[model samples]
Target: MTKEQLCEYRELQKEIKRLQARIEKLKDKNEGYVADVVKGSSIEFPYTQHPILIEGFDAEKKQASISRFKELLSKRVEKSMNRSIEIAEFICNIESVKIRTIFEYRYYDLMTWQQIAYKIGVTDESYPRRIHDKFFEDSPN
Candidate 1:
């Protein structure tokens, strides 16, 4: 590969690493939030009554709800990553390096398919359908 191509590859690698770190940080935060909710409830329930028992219960409930939301976000992130990996592997197998890059940038990085198509010198109207077709073609029945 040319020097410019090598530099671009390094930049893309850095971007992917940064995104992975963000995903990890979000997952860790989600776990910590869940833990806080559990700990707060455990301390407040079935034991010596604190003065602000009702307030503690309310706080615990709110925390629990927030923790649930965080859990959902974490799960969605994991699902997205898994789907991207599957798509990337399929594209790689097809020997379509450019399309694989476009797919990763659009799906994994959360850019629109239209944006990806434009970047790859295509029109927006058929971009999503094309990608969808490629994905299903590669997917197991």
Candidate 2:
């Protein structure tokens, strides 16, 4: 992939992970969920045309509708993930282990640069970042 394409690597990883999580939540929602239901209480009036038809909303039907909606949402997330995987894979194919680790920790692990510097045994915060930036800046177009 072109360096320009690789520029989007970090964002793609972040988006892919976010989409994956949403997909999982949607799947879980499809299973089922609890909902608050107010007790059915109908008021009777002397001059009413007919007695209040006091039947609470159908929980079964409501839950089913919610599940279907979640299923639809899951499909959308899956489609987004499909597009994201290509960029994520391209980023992962980077030859340098350190660069890969930087992306993984920064994007996937969601760690600060200070944290990454510490994990990688770099004393200077800018050292890791400089190397990362240099890799991209010096890439042959």
Error of model 1, residue 67, in angstroms:
16
**Candidate 1: RMSD over Cα atoms?**
13.4
The residue-by-residue lDDT of candidate 2 on 1-141, one tens digit each, is 554565555565566577567656653453333445344443664543433344444668656776777677667666656656776775588799998888677655767788889999988888777876787777774
lDDT per residue for candidate 1 within 8-112, as digits (tens), equals 443454555665666556533433232222223236558654333221234565566656765765665565556545555554664566656765565446566
Scored by lDDT, model 1 comes in at 0.54
Model 1 TM-score on a 0 to 1 scale: 0.33
Stretches of candidate 1 exceeding 4 Å from the true structure: 1-94, 138-141
Each candidate: what lDDT? 0.54, 0.66
